[model samples]
Target: MPALEHVQPLEHRSGRTNVPGAHGFLGRLRRRRAQREHEASVICFANALRGMFRDACAGIGLCQYVSVAAGITVRTPRVAEVRLGPPTSFTVELMAGQEPADFTSKDRGPRLAHTLGAHGLRVEPVAGRWVRIHLLDADPLRDGFGLPSLAVATGAESVILGRTEDATTLGHAIADPAHLGVQGQNGSGKSAFCYGLLAQLAAAPDVLVTGSDITGLLLGRAWDGTAHRAHQVVGTQDIAAHAVLLEDLVAEMDRRLETIPPRRDTIRPSPATPIVLVVLEEFPGLLRAADALPKPKRGEGIPVGDRIRTAVLRLLSEGRKAAFRVLMLAQRFEATAVGGGYARDQFALRLSFRVPADSLEMLHGADARPLGQEHANAAPGVAYLSGLGRDCERIRVPYLGEYGEYVDRVQRFGRRAES
Candidate 1:
């Protein structure tokens, strides 16, 4: 009747239906099988990852995390990446009686990525989207808890550094003259951390502090000899002095190391602990100087540059045991700004404050994309840390004004002086 339908011509040799029931069923079966295969692959990869991780834990005293490079392959919906897709708690469960436990599910991924990258495989592909990361080598330093380490208060003794929510120092005391590292972009809390450190250390008994900032003005007020005698020289020094300063610091580090105290429990507060802390504001200054001249020309006429380089190398190689900690302060902590590789690696501890989207890598480690996701535009005094522990953590430092006042009153004169 609808000859009208003008079903014109079913132009097909085989009269075909728009929805082929049999073909659709066959396609569905194929998809289901593919999915099953993908799932199986993921399980196999995950197990492989678990085994690799166990091996890493055994080799390295510390626990480690593995990231499967899922992008290398395709994964079915049934297979999910066993990673912190968001800012999540990361943890790793270790094998039985491993002495040190492995990463629990509560640790974050970026931190895991940094630690593993140092001694593990990267961008490994698994079945579909899965990957099995094999982390090798281990850290020798054990945390106070004998597991994953915590960020202890890196402040001079008696300075009253506040504890972050994730870490509590109710009874814990930091080493005096704590080497501090502050990193952030322009307007980040680099200056703030510097100010806080100076003031806090000043409060400690008989503590001496000094620092230099190339791109800041706040240090002028807090460290101005005319106003504050905290011993900070503000404004950029001529390249000559800048070069010599590093050499002097190296000498200082050597001297300090010679003074390291034996691990003692006298509870009498050993005087061997250094009370002076030096903060280098804007660490790029040294890196820039070093890279400008070739090794031969570095100290050719002036020995200053060569000496500085040697000093830094020695400090990095031996400062930790000597107790001569260096505090590197910068607006950002990128490999380039910090002189990359050797120079950048010298500073083991790095603290990034509020920074721009592109600079998280400087503050954290190279694999900071995940941290960028969470703290791209975070406020000053807030930062994410890795290498400091088994997982990356977001931290908020307390703000401090009147650094000199804090030093004079709370630190030196006691709380009564503040009133």
Candidate 2:
């Protein structure tokens, strides 16, 4: 959570020399050029220090086993060693924007365990273009303890994943499952964040997992070889298939309801079985299509805009007992987008990302008029997650390259349906 400060040059190897008389004329020009170059180098050095500090903070916050100290060691032009407790596997990592090819330096220590550093982390650059640095961990750096794949800590009823500077962003207890809702804009990392949640849920022994998406890409290859055996990527263009799938789900919901015992009115899903997560990407498409019908169910006195509203309300009222949870994604928020009080209350957690100026009223509240005007079009993967007591806070979700690997491995086991 520490911020970068101005770094003064500890030493400068290059300097301009003033010549007298004969070379004086040409010397002035040379001196000017040399001064510029020196200044540029000094800037690079200082900027590198800030980057190293940021990376060290990120590592300490992110890693389960690694604890980085405030100390930083600059070995050369682009090489830095961060002291985070005793060296273990990867005590030192190549900071982002620093390439091994930039300045060549070699060091010996423990055997290298991991060569490919965390990739896809976006960082701003003060000089040149933004770059991603690779993290390396070798034998010399290994501490006696092995790091856990994920280290989650729940304190003060708040959840802290990795390291975060913002206090209210992630440390709150997860609200009731039924009250969770998330909203985000395009490329805001909402999809990726959802994937991470799915992974975490899958790892839990008591939960079942089932998910479907209208767009074939949102779920993508993330669920390739995990515990999920049945996956549905419903295409919006195919209305017939889509309707059939919905009918089946309705029947499934009814079936689950019937299983509730008379004495014990509570409906419980078997822990071994996977629960269904109906992930609708841009669900408005389905609502619009349903409303196109001549005599669709509009609920009692509900207008035509009530199609989605009714559906959402139905899910909220009855879906929970059936072990069906809705994870809906939309690009925008509009009154006509989702119908009635049902749509309004169906999603308890709403997340917003780079939303349109006009949609703020529907997404955030009428009072968000000010924010809507100064809307910060957050970068891809950045979002504001609200709901379950985790109010809207700016966040950047990290992508675990493991998805690609999962896809490759699953495809090897069996061919994926191309169509």
Error of 1 at 208 (Å): 2.7
lDDT (Cα, tens digit) per residue for candidate 2, span 141-243: 1122111233122111222322121222343323234534455566665565555454434443334344345565545445555544354545556544545
TM for candidate 1 is: 0.50
lDDT of each: 0.47, 0.46
lDDT of 2: 0.46
Which parts of model 2 are misplaced by more than 4 Å?
1-175, 203-208, 220-233, 261-265, 272-274, 288-312, 339-341, 366-370, 401-419
lDDT of 1 at 379: 68
- Candidate 2, poorest ten consecutive residues by summed lDDT: 104-113
lDDT of 1 by residue, 190-230 (tens): 67655554544443433334444555454444343322333
Model 2's C-alpha root-mean-square deviation from the true structure amounts to: 16.9
Query: Candidate 1, after superposition: displacement of residue 220 in Å?
Result: 5.6
